[model samples]
Target chain A: MTGETVMFWVLAPLTVFAAVGMLLVKKAVHSAILLAFVMIALAIFYIAQDAPFLGIVQIVVYTGAVMMLFLFILMLVGVDSSDSLVETIKGLRGVAITTSLAFAAALTSLIARAEFGQEPLGLVSANANGNVEGIANLIFRQYVWAFEVISALLITAALGAMVLAHSPKSSEARLSQRARSVARFRGASIGTAAGLPGSGVFARHNAVDVPALLPDGKPSDLSISSVLAERGDVQETKRYALDGLPKLDEEDK
Target chain B: MTEYASLLLDDPIWLVAVKALLIFVLCVLLTLLAIWGERRIVARMQLRVGPNRVGPFGLVQGLADGVKLALKEDLIPKAADKVIFIIAPIISASTCFLAFAVIPMTGKVLFFGEETVFQLTDLSVGVLYILAAASVGVYGIVLAGWSSGSTYPLLGGLRSSAQVISYEIAMGLSFVAVFMYAGSMSTSEIVDSQAQWWNVVVLFPSFVIYVISMIGETNRAPFDLAEAEGELVGGFHTEYSSLKFALFFLAEYVNIMAVSALATTLFLGGPAAPPGLSFTESWLGGWFTFIWFILKVALFFFLFVWLRGTLPRLRYDQFMKFGWKVLIPVNIAWILIVATLRLMTQEGASQFMLAGFIITVVVLVMLATTIYESSKAKAEAAARFVPEMPEPSFPVPELPKQKRVEL
Candidate 1:
């Protein structure tokens, strides 16, 4: 077998497995990652098939930009958000299964009836100048109209996203830096005028979980982060107080 | 496949393995040297002593650090994703080395009596392959951050992915100018086309854009917001320890070298000698060209170090704004001009026409920028104007007279 054949055999199974795993993965992030794997594998297949331009574009546009964005949104939404599996619409599962089976059967029959040789027809002549130039010629000449339409569609999609995301400024005039500073200084309590003390300030222990100590030997509530406090990860300062520690000489006895 | 690719295709299996091994060693060695050089250079810039302990001039400091890291206790956070946490660093380290495959480090040379180019494989879309490798490299960072199951890592991961994705567009757009000039994406062909003049001279704007984008793409200062130490506390690797942390570090340095080498290939004309010293290319059976390649790559590495030493990390919002609003738009405009110029030249436009076209475009761009700047300034001034202050409604308190007593 040729190297390409060997590579195809090695990668084809892995690609299928990854693609299937993408659907089965519990976490949305995992599914996204599996899909990325499948996309990359498909890119390799393209390169192996002598379509290096398509292969690299696959990786760049799909795995790189699109999948990264997918993962980014998943991260923002929370990685623990998994496939619901719950049927939101009535008879949705039945419809999905029927459609997928019909599509698979149609695909199989079409491939079986296709009049192609065992060996792939390589793009050796078409890519005589270079794969990039060959693809460029096709894109700018033969498929120019389609390409233009696709670009228009992309621009419209981008505009739609921007419009959806854009939030109109409120009627209230935005506060200037000077106004913000003046308001802060003139506010109800002057305690946080400079800013709240950072966590672990004057606490000896510099970890974020430790709250700063007040002058009256009390822990300052404002010093520790609310997140840590709410998570119950805060360390009690009394345990590390100097008075509570054993003396070195007493420990020797 | 191009000539270099056909040459690579004729390679024996053993020779191919050797080439792969050589590329692997080159990358790892470059990573180590980059780490050492960055420290020494930054130290000099800061007027401080860098690593001088262990091997002479601390040349093996990176190696020593690697060993120490290996020997240290490996820690996995209780809440971390076990499988992905383990795979993340491996993915990070591997994808970085993959980019070197398409990067031609030298011209034809004899490797164990086999004539081969000093590259693993030269795909027709070689440059795109590098970009693909870089894009895949992002997964390593993102996954490391996510699988760590911590807040800081997640934030750092998101920042890095966003930064890389934003900058990759500008970087890709910059390459379009070079592709136009060379008329091919294969690394070797591009290098060959630059025999007369380097792309750095012909495509200066693209070079500048690529340099800036590469810096941001690699997450180096002043674009290192993703792993800002003051904020993220070691960023995505906060939850990692020992060897896993080392793998991330390795990947970071390897990525630096990868992009630097790519910059050298695209802008500095690959492994070609200096213009005046072009004769030296055929010297030593074409092996000396590898030295020139190293020198060019080293120059870029120094630039990376210099920027890191001189600049401060940018604010996240401002950095994002600069990438999207500044770098990308400029890059797109440059690409359009380049494409039009290429088209005109190919259509056999007269010299006078080409010059006039270029001059008109330049003047128009300048005028548009000036107008845009003036309008923006006016809007900013209007926004800064504060309304007239009103007099206090309540009466002001009178100061006590002659209350001070001299001691």
Candidate 2:
């Protein structure tokens, strides 16, 4: 077998596995990651088929921007929010299975009946002037109108998203930085006027989880983030204490 | 097809393997040097001696650091997803090296009695391949953040992903001009097309946009919001320790080199000798071209270090705004002008006419910018002129009715 066929045999099963894994994965983040893998594998297939331009675009546009955005939203929405098995719509699973099966069968039949006039003609001749140039000629010359229409459509979609996402600014006067600072100092207590002390400011260990030590040799509750404290991720300060140094009382004596 | 691509295609399997290995080693070595160079250069810029105690001139300081990092205790946070946490760095480190595959690092040179270029392979879509590799690299940081199962890392990861996405658009837009001018995306062809004048001179705006975009792309300062130490702790690698953290560090530096090399290839003319130094191209059996390439990359590397030393990190909102609102629009406008110029040249426009066209475009752009700035300033001034300040009103609670008796 040729190297291309060998590579195809190696990658096809993995791509399929990853695609299937995306659905089976419990976590949305993992699903997104698996989808990225599938996209990358498809990109390789494109490259192997002599469509290097499309292959790279598959990677740049799909795996890169699109999948990254998917993962980004997943992170924002909380990655731990796993899929719910409970169907929200009545007979949804049945409908999904039936449609998927029908689609698969149609795809199989289409592939089976596909005709090859002779030995397949590769893109070598078309890409003689370089893949990008060849594609550009098609895009800018023959199919320019179609390309322009597609671009217009994309721009419209982008604009639509912008309009939907945008919210009008509040009518109330916004506080300037100076005003905010002045208000901060004048509020309930000025104890934290400058700012709340950062975690591990005066601690032996300066890790984020290590709470700073107060003057009386006690850990300050306000030093570490409340989230971290709530989660019980804070490190024990006893081991990190500067025991080698003389005590304050002894120094005073 | 370019000479380099054709040559690369004819390379036997063993030669391909050797070239791939060579590229991998080169990247790793460059990463090490980059790390040390960044520290040393930044230190000198700040008037401090850096890493002087390590091997000669601290040349092997990065190696020392690698060893130290590997030997350090590895920690996996209790909450982290184990499998993904391990894979994240591998993906990052691997993809950075992948970008090097298409970058022409030298002129045609003899290696082991076979003629080859100092590159793994050159795709017809070479520039796109580099960009694709870079995009894939984002997954490393994102996965690192997500799998860490921590707030800081997660926030860092999201910020990085967003930053990369926005900047990648501007970066791609900048490349549009280069592609239009060169008429090819292959790195070698682009380099060859710049025989007389580099893209940096002809496509100055694209170069500027690309340089800015690349800094943001690699997550370097002042665009290094991904690892903003103050706010996000260690950012996406907050929970990473030992070798995993080292991998991220290696990937970060290697990515810087990758982008720098790309900048060299696209704008500076990859592996080409500087002006008035044409004779040097024949030196060392064309291996000198590799040296020239490295010098160009080093120039960019120094720029990265200088920026890191000089500029403070940009606020995340401002950085994002700059990328999307400013850089991208400017890039698109530049591409339009470039495309028009390319078309004019293709249609045999005279030098006088071309010069006049360029002058007209520049003047119009300048005039528009001035007008926009003035209008923005006027709006700001008008907004600042508030008529009066409202009385500060805060909610107050009344004392309990029976409080006096209770007290």
TM-score of 2: 0.83
TM-score of chain B of 1: 0.94
Error of 2 at B318 (Å): 0.4
Q: Total clashes, candidate 2? A: 0
TM-score per model (chain B): 0.94, 0.93
Residue B62 in model 2: shift from native, Å? 1.6
Per-residue lDDT, model 2, residue A88, is: 98
Best by TM-score: 1
Residue-wise lDDT of candidate 2 within A34-76, one digit each (tens)? 8999999998998888888889899998888888878778788
Which 10-residue window of candidate 2 chain A scores lowest in summed lDDT?
A: A240-249
lDDT of 1 by residue, B1-407 (tens): 45666788888889879889988888888888888888999999999889989799999998998899999999998888898899999999999999888888987788889998889877777898899999998999999889898899999999998999999999999999998898788888898889899999999999999999999999999999998999998788889889999889989988988999999999998998998998898989999999999999899999999999999889999999999999989888888898998899899999999999999998999999899999999877756655544333322222334244689
Instruction: Write the residue-wise lDDT of candidate 1 on A1-253 in tens digits.
Output: 9999999999999999999998887888888889999998998898887788899999999999899988888888885566788889999999999999999999999998998666764677877876777888999999999999999999999999999999987997786776556655555434567788787644586588776655434556677788887898876756543344344445555
> Candidate 2: global Cα-lDDT?
0.86
